[model samples]
Target: MQHLEEQIAHLTRTVEELNSVVTNQQSEIDRLTRRVEMLLQREAERAQEGSGGVVFGDERPPHY
Candidate 1:
């Protein structure tokens, strides 16, 4: 009876510790996910600002 109670207490503490670890990991993951999303959004906007690759035939090239 006492031994069982001790085991339960130990297991409870372990579960609480694991829950804390999981919570911290989830917070970190959320931060990273937001950062990645912001980076991708910036990249998308940058892509949108680029030229469409075609230029007029009369335009001077870079070698000029």
Candidate 2:
């Protein structure tokens, strides 16, 4: 009976440790996702700016 109780305690401790590790990994994933979204927004802005520059793609006025 004592041996059985000891085994149960050890298993419970192992499961608790694994749960903490999974929780930490989820938080890290959320942080990285936000960073990627910010980078994508900045890239889109840069592309739009390039398409509207002088002597590039935008149209010029009359009297040239």
Candidate 3:
């Protein structure tokens, strides 16, 4: 029926829009994941080299 067809079309469009949004979100997640991994690796390397320069709570830096 015409009504059924219209409903189906609307549903299809909604699904497509949702799929696009999900795809974009996935891409952003992947990008952020990569950035986190890179930062972790960089931090690890800095730690191994003993040059992390990380300040702990209540601990004054050498320059201060």
Candidate 4:
């Protein structure tokens, strides 16, 4: 029937739109994940070297 066909078309469009949004979100998530991993690796490397004269939150200030 014409009504059934119209419903199918609408549903198809909705599905395709959702698929596009999900794909974009996935790409963004992947990019962010890579950035986080790179940052963690860099921090680890820094730790392996020395504290680099960095101060900790709990420690007293240099003027103390």
- Which candidate has the highest lDDT of all? 3
User: After superposing candidate 4, which stretches have Cα over 4 Å from the reference?
Assistant: 56-64
lDDT of 2 by residue, 1-64 (tens): 9999999999999999999999999999999999999999988887788853346356665456
Off by over 4 Å in 1: 51-64
Pitting candidate 2 against candidate 4, the one with the higher lDDT is 4
Reference-based TM-score, model 4: 0.80
TM-score of predicted model 1? 0.78
Query: Each candidate's lDDT (Cα)?
Result: 0.90, 0.87, 0.97, 0.93
Model 2 C-alpha lDDT versus the unseen true structure: 0.87
Candidate 3 error regions (>4 Å):
55-59, 62-64
Over 1-64, each residue of candidate 3 has an lDDT whose tens digit, in order, gives: 9999999999999999999999999999999999999999999999999998868899987887
**Candidate 4 residue-wise lDDT, 4-55, digit = tens:** 9999999999999999999999999999999999999998988889764678
Which residue window of length 10 is worst by lDDT in model 4? 47-56
Task: Give the winner by lDDT: 1 or 3.
Answer: 3
